[model samples]
Target: MPALDLKGCLDDSPKFRKRIAVYEDSIQHFEFSLKTLTKLTRLQVDSSTEYSQRQQELATDFTSFAQSQDDPIIAHALEKFGKSMIEVEKCRTMFVSRMGQAAYNPDVKPVIQNSHVTETFISPLEKFVKETLFPIKELKKRFEKASDEVDSVLSRYMGKKPKDPTILETAKELADARKGFYQVYMEYVSKLNDIEAKKKVDYMENVLAYMYTKSAFHHQSYEILKDLEPYMRDLTGLLNDTRQRHDEETSESSEYQDLCAQSAVDIYNPLNAVSSSTVSSPGITVPYHNTTENPNKSGYLFERKGGRVMQSWIRKYFSIEGEYLVCSMRNTKTSKDDDQSASYNLRVCSIKLSDSYDRRFCFELISPQRIIVLQAENEKDMHEWVNSLRMVNQKALNSDKAPPPLPSLHRRGVSDVTPVIKLNGFSGSSGTVSDSDKELLKMVREKPGNDKCADCQAREPEWASTNLGVIVCIDCSGIHRSLGVHVSKVRSVVLDKWETESIEVMLELGNTIGNSIFEEHVPSDMETFRINPNSSPIERDLWITEKYVKRSFVAHKDDKAQETVNQTFWDAITEGNLAEGLRYLARGANVDYRNPNEHLQTPLHRSVQLGNEVSVEFLLQWSSNVNEIDENGWTNLHYAANSNNVRLVLGLLKRHAKADIKDESGKTSLDLAVEHQNVQAVTALRLFAFDKQHNSSPANSLDFGFREAMSSFKQNYSFERSHGTSHSALDLRQTKSHSPKESSSLHETGSKLLRSDSSQ
Candidate 1:
């Protein structure tokens, strides 16, 4: 559109107004279009960047697959394909980068002296809208105001008599208003003209720049792909040949039909399936099985007596090659790299089924040098492995060429490995330790500071303090046991059967975390205070006592007033904020801080009363005596039982809360639980009583049956909570700051309800 005439603006005619309105509308449309373009451009750049990243990830996957391939030709072809894909990904990544730069700043320029200004650089379209269009809107507003003032002044001047004193004043006001109107009108018209020209030229120029950047990106990508054309064609030809060879092998396999006729569960052969491309047949896929005639067999198996003293079983990759039984040694933190692969001569070894052994799927390879015992995953796997070994051994014996002589076994010290997630119970709990324990043991020992003793830095810590979540040497464990269960509950990682929750506790806080907490403030100058691997029993005892019992090295905050610290502690407990509570505890907030306003209940008591087990555990970690009594003589256990929360009751007992301790009412927690008819809570308390009778550690209370019962109960309880099922006693209530009288009244009402339920 042509610019609105300055002369027309001076006339202030209806025609001029109409023309200006059209220009203003066009400017609004232009602004909207530019915003849309900018938004779409940003989205396109983001999408392209994501696409490039995904392609790069796919290329990496291709490279990994190539490394795992057995066929040399296929592997080579895949490697070439992977490299080409990576190159294409790089091109796409470059394109994304260029596109982003083009959208953000089409014209590259040297950054200014100030880094902050460089970071805030606005794109061309955005800059034009902000710096050019916004000011034009402001000018238009000023022009309208000036025009209104001139019209008002002129009307008054025209209304006055020619000779009147007011006539001269009105005329002078009219002239001043008209002059201001003229200046604003000219500026507004000038801005309108400038923007109109910019809208036509600048926008087209930006579009041109976008097209150029896009064209350059496509050309670069094309050139990159063009370079790989010959290699891609060759790879395709090689893949075609591989497919033809595979077809030939499938057709010539005499055992394929026999394998298919066998039970589907016993054997899987995908070659027996009807092809999807068959015109008249239904596409039926069968289970896949390798049909190669090779007698070689390799897979993961449990190797007995592999580690030191032959006490632990270790998983090893076993493969039969010719007459040698090759075992791949894994690199664990506890294992050395001296023997990466161990080979046993099958020609001199006698294979026998271990049907008489305690463990299922056991077999023994009796070699002239040493007996190599192995366990398979199942009976079928075991038989298959035995058959493969026998076949290889017989073939070796019949060969005209003499086999290699028997070699000595290279024994490495293997730590007892266990699974982190417990699949079965042990010792104080029910059931024998399963083979799943190996991985968990390895995982725990591999944790930082766990490979060595937490106290003496002894290699391969076999014992762990369950409550403290630290692994220690056998010698250190004896000291930990002496410190009392409340200080550190010790358990044998290998010997003791683990509960899921206990293992989770250990995994959550390994030796690294334990040392970080206990030895947080250990002085560098006091080297004598720290015990080494060579430290004597007396030195270790003194160090352990100072570390766990005395907590001499624990960081403390003495700066905060006792009142402020106690108040913060109460607030954290009330809000169920474990992190904040732990922080304040380190800052000298008493874990046993009594809330005077809430019947002088300690943090632990209050947490149980509020049904906050998480906060209760947090308090226990900070050494909050679970046996501490409230003003009403109610302990945390008493509160937990009265609440009828079975989980909470179990947790308290596990933490060594005195279950037998009587309250002011002359009733123990178990008595209260039974009176309230809290069946789960009562059961938990009774089982705990039995556990205390049989076991020294209160934490190891649940047997297999009881553990299963509790597990089921927990699942059901969780389901109820998740689905918003309401329970009168177990419902978690929101706690608020209340006056002493109100708090007392609330507790009284709760007590009355419990009494009412018991009486009924």
Candidate 2:
């Protein structure tokens, strides 16, 4: 690469510089014109469809013009200009889409015939001022600042010459300076880029704040305005009064100067002296007491005496003639006696009052274990008396009694003794027992004679106990019986697992019957052996491992039995059968039974997905927990909606099934109906949403209910009639198809109805 001289390139020609300047000027004018035109067009356009089309055209034109420019600086400017145009267009589109044109456009001519064209003409100017031209002003200021900086640099380098330098000389000097200035200018450009990025963030924040503030103002404007009315009235009155005072101040008269002076002496003199003396003066002396120990503790008693002393001192100092001499007290203490067993401790303190130039006193006496203050007219006098009584008592009380320590574990001994066993047994010769024992013994010794029917209380004399201890009569008992059916049913209804288990166990124990001899002397192996018929197919195929039991029963070995079960299952599902299927399932038939090579769907799934309403309803009634999702990740409602089966959707929704369930494509039943333009299905989904909103807790009023209904109708109408399809059965032909008289008649009728509805 060649190392080109930037200085030489700059110094080449003044014409080049002039060309650049002219290009910038033209670009600025072009931007302003384009902005103005855009605003005018936006104001005029009534429909979003037209606005979007116009915006696309504007973007294409600006982009084309930018691409046509060859100069790098001009091209860069054009690119920025195109971006600004695109941004404004985008903002316009967003505004129209969110708020609609009716909000942005205002009627300009009420006197003339009502028309949108008048409002449209003024829109371009509004847009230019609001969006485009306002931003341009800031851009112009920045450019001006940059131009000033460039001029300053040029002047500094050129110096104060006698005359203006020649264009060539000036260009050469600027060109030389431009090399270094460009580097610095580039830094400023980088800073501007940072500022612009921050401004974008700040602009977005401001827009959000403005939107929130506008919403809040809309909600509270009435209340705020109402509150401000009274304050505004009061402010007006005050302003008027101030103005009157200002006018009259230049025309006032003075009088009663002597009377004012006398009133000042009578009232202000005493008040002034009181106010001045309220705060303590720096040099004012207050009576204080010093005692042997803690004299201030009894200072409250010296308050009156201190006041008298202060009055006396004040009178003496000021030479005022007053009968009462209220002076604040000094110290008042007496010496200790030689016969005293303890020392006296006095306490004293003072409080300065702001309302008067006097200090209140406090005094107390302290001993080794107790404190006492003497009551007097003032604290200063109390302090003197309290100090004299300080030696009365000063000693601590003593008592001697210690608590014992806690005992250790090793010190506590344990005793071992066997408890006597009292066996309550039935009377057998010498072994005599009580009546309760006899009853218990009989219950334990007697055989479970009969298997009691839970429903009728009928006893079956000939009965046998299964391995599970369920007592059954020979007639009712079957080889295929298992505990799984009962367990499953119990688990389904009962919420607590442990509680269900306990109930099942108790029921089994109560129903079981056994011979008395076997009950009392049964081996552990007998209890461990279980004849489980409801075992899984794989488990049923295994041979019995117990050596004691030589043979095991296998129901599948009988081909008739297997065929009967399969036929029963098929018949149950075919007849839209719920009871038969549940019976078969409970009887240990294969639940995953298939017809042939086709993908196997369970009886529950088939009845739910494709069966008649009665069949589905029957299946649901039989098994409340048959929740099956199909191969397409669709529930029953999805299949029903896709098939436009309104009744099925209603049934499923009635059963609390979700309508907005998304399929494998992430499309819900509503979305699918919308995609297919199924009016009935869409209406059903919307009605469901409306009902949900209406039936919500804390029911809404009639207006809200009507509004919700209307909204639902509108939404469904839009969805159905979106692609220019007639929403209703009414297919009224256009007026153009008839004569002018017919067209006029139709227009008049339509206008009347519109007016009537608008009035309502």
Candidate 3:
């Protein structure tokens, strides 16, 4: 490169400070803008679909702009600008999410306060100011001082002849100083030219063209705060009377509408529209990805032991989908084509380090009410699972449209739920439904609104889904039912029998209520066609599957309730599920809980009547009172004595149950056993009564009960598996069942029972 003429005419004075001050002002403005954005971000106006879409659009735009930069300095400037903008967006998003949490949960502290703006947004730009712009400003002052020294020397030597010795010496000094100052000016101009073109002379003119676009985006984003922030109550996290913006999510975005139209269960996959791409159950899809970027694993997870089921490792496929980490279970028995792939909508899934005390290489995959702990084969696989899931969790959090939180189905067919029109007639009292039911029915009868069929939006819909609680037209009901009862349990409003509490569930979860829970984050705002009541089955099937099964339009709630209701407390007694009862006991429920609607009887009384010998044993293990009476004055002994189950009767008796307790009819356990002609039960009780009669000494109740227990144990005793199963075997019948002290008590009781029998 040829050295350009070193002559510089630019003046050196306090005037250069004025030029530098402008850049300082710009830096301050940028920092202030970032601070403002950080403060605004905490508002969490996630309901605005346009803003969310715009955010993604901005990211793509930034990428393209960065790519287009050719000059090194300008590229670096754009790069920093893009990064700073991204940081601002990130800070804003986090703030909104925190604000959203605070809105729903009073307990969660407000998002990280003003530091959100200061830390992520303002700090970065301020650093840029200090490192880049401030240095340039300081150098400009030095350049001015150098220029003044050269200028004064040159003026003193000007108009003097070369023969003058003073003039010649001053001229030599000015030239050397002028050369150094020229270099400083060029370097200063180079840095300033990167962020702004101040003039074409600053650098190659085209180098800063991209700055205009960057500036425009920042201005647009900055102004957007004014439009949306007022509607958000918690930018500062002050108060309430707030409601979720489900309507905004549904009514405004066409792109989401397109995604909804495309994502049917049969023809589409929320993971992608490939058929049976991965092994998955309803809402837990681990999608199959072809790219090397995503990690795919066929692994195992221990599903939490639920009602009457023990913990078992389930085989599953795990995949890293864009912004979503999905894990799906596989079933070998399923031959259906769709079942071959991951059919679950794992949109709402999340991850955490395992709290598992016993297992190693484990982490938890969480969905709405469901949590699964997965164990990797080794540390490498565990890290992979953790890293991929965390990335997707973060990715999904950044997205404006997150997948719906689950209990979502993956079956694609015409198993449409009937519209929940008429509340079931069995709504508690007088063989009638309540006014709430009537009001809901009246609303259902009104012209179709947000409450209409989720698939076709058909008015006068007739069926409902028990899980999602959304009503569909009768035509769509067939489609939902086709997905099978596991996917969506379709029920009728006027035909099927309904539990009073179930009716209450429907009442509390009508269309609007259902929308709030399932459609909290709406994917699209486009209106969809409602299937005519007479539409073809195929059409209804496709629509229903797309709407409910794939959950194309469903968005995960920012603030869904995570509290487990332990509803199984009542279900255990009704179903005689021992595991279910035990789970509640472990969760600290009352073993003596009486179901007021079920004759005010505790679970023990119910278990005995139902002949659930195992359930009764499990309930008793929790220290339930065996002699507790129910509404009819029938104790557990009374119920067991009249039943055909000899095991249940024996189990109760071995627990030292009171045989003399009377029912309302003055019938004792022996009386009921004999009266009912229950052969085995009668024999057991007769032996107990005979033993009692023969041993009529002045023994305390404990001794008398112990003797009866010995007789019952001897009668029912069998040689089953005698080692691991010993303690599991009922009470005294357990082979090698007791310690020395316990054995001595049993031996003494057995001897007494033998003496009583012989005496008799």
Best by lDDT: 1
The collision pairs in model 1 are: 417-437, 417-438, 418-437, 418-438, 418-439, 418-440, 418-441, 419-437, 419-440, 420-440
Question: After TM-score superposition, what is the CA distance of residue 270 in candidate 2 from its true location, in Å?
Answer: 88
Candidate 2 wrong stretches, greater than 4 Å = 1-571, 589-600, 608-611, 624-627, 675-677, 693-760
Q: Give RMSD to native, each candidate.
A: 30.2, 40.1, 33.4
Each prediction's TM-score against the native?
A: 0.33, 0.21, 0.21
Give the per-residue lDDT digits (tens) of candidate 2, residues 1-760.
1122334233535664454345345445645655666555455444643565466566556656756665433343344444444434433433233333342232321122212222323343344346643564465455456656667767765674556557567667677656555564444334334334433454345445435433432323232233233323433443566578876764442223433433433223312323222323422212322243332222223222134354321111100011111122233332232112222221122112222334333333333454322234344344444443332111111213232232221322211111111111100111122344445333322335334521112354222222222333211221112222232121101111112112222232333221221132334654444324322212222212221122222122234475467657756765755444544443455544443422344454455556355555534433433334555666666666665555556556656778766877897777665555454455556656666776562122222333333333333333433445332112323312222343233333333433333344
lDDT of 1 by residue, 405-490 (tens): 54444442212222122123212212224445556666777877789998998887777887677899755766776677777776
Instruction: Mark the 10 consecutive residues where model 2 has the least summed lDDT.
Output: 315-324
Summarize candidate 3's per-residue lDDT along 1-760 as a digit string, tens digits: 1122223225533555455556546645654654455345434343422253355356546655755655332333334344434434533443323233342222454453333333333444455545655576687787678768777877777868768878767778888888787777666555554545432222222223224323433443453332223222121121211122445655545555665555545433332433244433332333332222233443454433333345545555655545434555467674454234332334467777875436677788777876666776545456666766665566666778846554333543211221111111111121123455556554543423434676665665656765444576644655665686545666556433343334433443456644443344444443343345444444566655655556544543242322221345656655865434433443444777767677978878877787655466546544678888888988888887676454566566656688888878898876665555443455556655665676553122223244434433432332221222222112334344433443435434444443343344
What is the overall TM-score of model 2 with all chains considered together? 0.21
